[model samples]
Target: MFKDLYDVIVVGGGHAGSEAAAAAANLGSKTLLVTMSLQNIAQMSCNPAMGGIAKGQIVREIDALGGYSGIVSDNTAIQFKMLNKSKGPAMWSPRVQSDRMRFAEEWRLMLEGTPNLDFYQEMVKGLIIENGKVLGIRTSLGLEIRSKTVILTNGTFLNGLIHIGEKQFGGGRAGESAAYGITEDLVQAGFEAGRMKTGTPPRVDGRSLDYSKMNEEKGDDVPSKFSYLDSTKPLVHQRSCHMSYTSLEVHNILREGFDRSPMFNGRIKSLGPRYCPSIEDKINRFADKERHQLFVEPEGWKTCEVYVNGFSTSLPEDIQFKALRSVAGFENVKFFRPGYAIEYDYFPPTQLRHTLETKLVEGLYFAGQINGTTGYEEAASQGLMAGINAHLKINEKDPFILKRDEAYIGVLIDDLITKGTEEPYRMFTSRAEYRTLLRQDNADFRLTPMSHAIGLASEKRLRRMEVKKTASAQMVNFFRETSVTHQEANVVLAEKETALITQSDKMFKVFSRPQIDMQDMMKFEKVKEYIATHDLDTEILEQAEVQIKYSGYIDKERNNADKLHRLEDVKIPEDFDYDKIKSLSYEAKEKFKKIRPVTISQASRISGVSPSDISVLLIFMGR
Candidate 1:
């Protein structure tokens, strides 16, 4: 081997890069992580929290697959809540209000403790490409480090520009300097690049807020954690968030800065996240709404700073102050820092394969914001996968690709590499077709075996999974074998407003009722005795119940996915000429030739491709 050649080189040390480096090193690759500053590794760039809605599912999936994000979030969390608890188990997502500083420190310490990982502080300026393959990276200090495979998770630092009112500066974040050269180099190497903008809200002093005027939002009575591993427990005393709202006065003040607003004045040409808009954009778009909700959340347990969650703005400092003061609790607020928008370079992910490796540059991979994704969860999952694939490529092993039915991470990567997002992509429940089967409660059941097969998951995790499996199987068996008489089960069923049982029924059948839960079933002496004897954890019990309750829906989705996979397997020839197909419509021909979709199902999902067009293509391919 060359003097400084590493098996893998991971660029950037944000959420994606940190996870990527840790994963590659943990999987037996000698890895080098290059970042701008060591102190800023794994910093919460936009929010002082983790896991929300679909994002929480992604974090759990990461943890199940041997990634460290969930553990780190759990270690630093000040408050915990399981969102969407009123919905089905598939919709239940665990979230945490994290200590920002502690989260970064924990990630740094974890990476340092990994045996095969090495760290360097420097900005990667460009890659060393030889004959269409990435051989190494070149840093700003003119040091060249060779590696067999490289993963870029540069986040928002590639020629990043920050905007507040009309004042703009070149920086990755508020105080950090921008990275340069890589975007230009990639473009010259035949890669397509685009600009994307994302913003963060102002931080205010907690002591300055008048909380008595706002509504207090408390954590769930039974708090839950993010990690599948037993790394930490939920806090005994959780912090409470306050809720405020934007008044007409605040809207008027924000409108006053419209002339200098970069978003309005066309200074920001890139598309931002549709779901996460700035305060000015919200007021302008929903002009008829009387008010918008604002969440005042603490940054951490030790800091006096609070993050103004729903009040992201790029208005002038005076305008930000004048408008925030109009809100209920923020009437006497003082800002720790003003909110601003950052515009950064992103490569359309269509340029990458399913393995996250660049199609044009062999052995070079891209992840995180560099791939046009917005959230920390989205970035971390991508980074972990990219790191795994990079190490596999270096070792001459097969690429580790997750199927769409297997994980939310799979759905995310498949969407990115297939459709190529026009805006900054964030995860949503609606995006997954098989979400009925992809419950957060069963992430370990779905992913631990796969991770273990690939050598990323530990022996301890595999052993725990085995124990859980045995416990779940035993509990399920007991439920199926045990019967409850009408006299014993009728009252319990009626108490939940469900129909009273008329005859003896299996415990499994009763538990599967929509109205019944484990807690309610535990009222039966036999059920309680069985659970006590099995020594099953609440998570496994919940997972088994959901599996039984939603069996029909899950089966239906699986059948649908299997049917679609048939179409996916009917591959088109690489050089197939859509223009030569006379049966295809003019629009279909143009779109098919441009996108060059790999499968018939993908072509069918394209905007302009009709069902009739799909039939024509299928017939042409002898399907």
Candidate 2:
């Protein structure tokens, strides 16, 4: 049944694979998406939600770069939130609780409508490798498929083993069958593979829970969306999520199953997510604490399925039920399925280049859990970059890489390749030093141009971004050029508990006051008149305000970024002889030779490579 060779073949249908397939196809590469089952495409395997903290920033970045995650999330959301709203703009991230079914369906619709993509339902059992390059994939039924490039986003599926108390099974997820042969083949082919574990909370019946005893959580009154483009509508109404607490009674019951617990009984040796630990782990780790919070999240608008957030476990069914029922709202809860942990194979990302292309095999790329990344946003972002780079690679073009100052996506890929992850890696706002410049509010402003240049972002998106930039610039200019009188400023400044202006001064100065904000400054008749005359929206108004207020910090960070970028420009040949430099430390020499950092900046960031090593390299290259 094989016909012609495809340009790019994506071997998974999870978040990473979906984005990868969409990106390659959108860039004019004829793509094929192979999955074990079509029904589970883009399935929210864990919680039925998208984005939080730094992860929300990543989704926005993905949206800015012509990826479908944001649009999909917007269309599927039952509730929306702007996390850290009281904090600085950089920490404010948009998150949404999605309809579990709708999220997957929207993704399916998006992929089907995409021009150059084709789908196949089959488990990829092995890769068709020749020499040092990937040719395509071999399916479970023994059919071979050919492609110019292969992206393995085989999230938690390669030889996956599931553990639940004393029971164990072979499965990729709760119900899906585990994929085999691929990991074995890759390992035999010189790739180093290790097992990583992750677990999900039991899906409980919503109708069985008691909301009256729990703290009701609602969405923000004003809902914001993910897509910078106007494709998705703003949410007007929203669903409710509830919060409940686990008591000492719950812990006692959970402890009853300790001996049979797979996590503590040595049935699972791999590390689970540190930030999101299982209920059993939490109780054990913080034994002095009286309670732990449990978020009761809905699975879908219509379905009775509910996700027991903060209750991930792999204990026996009886113990799980007993412990959950002891919690406030879960007193009557019943499981759709008990929670379990899955251990799967991953190749340490240090084996890959910054482009996500494997150094061991050309035309081969890895993303998602296969690279040890943990979240949907993290996986999807990596997939988007890998897909873009893969397409660019086949066409003899230089790879597209986002710098650390440019996007959170850049920080993620760089950290993975340069540092290498022993445990599942997660993204946090603290991870990016240039957080001030990479705020979620300005993702489109930062990445749309680059995406457009790569042929992924549309002309319409580019125009939209330009309009925002132009309007914001005009707004900033008006603030700088216009003068506000002491009388005009005092009314606003006095209310904010700040000093009154001595005389008429530029609006920029008034805006720069710590207590005053753009909204406060807008109270002046002249400032209000300028905004009304210009017809600027909140987005433009806010961007201009932040720029004027934090100009000093922004400029300082930008200067530092520029200085570091100088080292980034110092190119080091991939085949450079680090061992020949006897002046370098033995550890530095080994690390430099292993990483083969492409630039002096990258070499400096390597774990064992020190400043003196960089100086030695600088002196060597000086010749």
Candidate 3:
């Protein structure tokens, strides 16, 4: 029996839904989180890890904007790593191997502790829509729970179907039942829906595997965390993951099951992630390659369960075991469960605005896999933005948006809405041309202030961000103002293979050399004194160093971003008649009418709309 209407009703309890519910509630909205099972809240459905490559930068951005992902990840992490240390700061990303059970536990605790939040364990079947606005949702038990707005982060649950060899069943995940009614109802209501496929690797017993036979992959010597918040703890004791490879014999055995693989056969029609294909797909596509690597990752601190990374397949159980046994370290293997592929329905993201709200249905937003995204980080980031925008829209405030140069979150949303994803959309560094400005190291500098302005980021978070800002400024000033003599600079410069300095130069100038790094600069007495005098933390020092060193590239990107943003500033009336413009290209007119881009910049980014078309529109608009 429900009486009062909730401000926001979040469906499902995966990374996206949890963050969405938390964000709305934290911002003072009365929210409801409805999931089929509360125990599975924030479950690591695939690998027992968070943050990889471009996905890691997204977690940092989510944390900076006052989302719970980073804090929960830090609390449950058994290992921490800073990926790509050899590359530029733009390429550096933070990752953590989490305790699967602990990760979900932390999420439930966070949601229960947050004010203005309530939980309901029920499968949402349909929406209660009146005219074009979402009034509430309908559950399986015929209970109609009313809410002002609803954020659907169902995450591979809507009409879900699982495939393992020839066996098939309806399931949201491995052990959960599939959700019904919603996708059909939405489609009937004029929404376009499509199917996308994703798979998981088998969970094997770690004790059965001989770790001594495999190479060890260790965490960072000095661990770092995702959150800017001081309270988020870093891992003190980290477990080691092992690396093993599939041999020619293993491949030969795996090929035997290719006929039965749902991916290879005509069973699975949906497109799976191109970058994270199954082992069968990999071997089939790259037949000449003799070996493929697999990372043996522990699922928890105490549990013997280990996730077999890079070995995703829907082959028969016996065939999987036989092939896996052929691997060097997996000679004696025991599986907790066989891996399988699942196909789920997802609404084309083109149906939604950049705010993540559906254009056809007011107050109804979509996040996570339901919008065709593939990773935990990507889903969580969408949930964060969707929650923020849902709250703002309900309160009659303008939608909160971040520019492309500001964050990876912005780039993700923009890409999804502008160019609808045919397959599972995963984040990549190459997608963001402005990645130099969207570095993981400076997510807070880019987004926390904006979130704080929206009253979503806590005052404590804002204060913490301010401290880092002030300290970085102080450190940069010290380098910019203090001049180092050639004698002093040459000491570290010679060791770094840099040309010997001829005259005294500012510490900033000395740091600009390709070989000069923070550690190398630390050898100088002036740099040491500056750190001690100012009490600068490593994060602050690093920020100052990167900013000063990459200032040229950063400045150039900012100029380019500014120029593009000018086109973005050119507003286009929603659903404007493109047919009236006779001078426009036929493809541009069709695309413009379909995309309904809010700005000229968005129009320019569309695949069919060329630069010539953009110029025509700009001239028509008298820009």
RMSD values, in order shown? 1.8, 1.0, 0.9
**Candidate 2 residue runs with Cα over 4 Å from true position:** none
* Cα lDDT tens digits for candidate 1, 1-623: 13678999999999999999999999999999999999999999878899999999999999999999999998899889899989987788889999999999999999999989999998999999989999999988888899999999999999999999889999999899999999988999999999999998999999999999999999888788888777577678889988889988889889999998999999999999999999999999999988999988988888999999998888888899988988887878898899999999999997888889998899899999999999999999999999999988888888898877889999999888877888999999889988987878778888999999999999899888788877777777888899999998998988988888789999889988998888888899998887788677787787668767887898898899898888878777767898878999998898777666767866776667789999998888787
Per-residue lDDT, model 3, residue 517, is 84
Deviation (Å) of 353 in candidate 2: 0.6
Note the Cα lDDT for every prediction shown: 0.89, 0.92, 0.93
Model 3 RMSD, rounded to 1 decimal: 0.9
Cα deviation of 591, candidate 3, in Å: 1.4
Please list the residue runs of candidate 3 whose C-alpha ends up more than 4 Å from where it truly belongs after superposition.
Answer: none
Clashes of 2: 0
Candidate with more favorable, higher lDDT: 2 or 3: 3
After superposition, the stretches of candidate 1 with alpha carbons farther than 4 Å from their true spots are 572-582, 585-598
Ranking by lDDT: 3, 2, 1
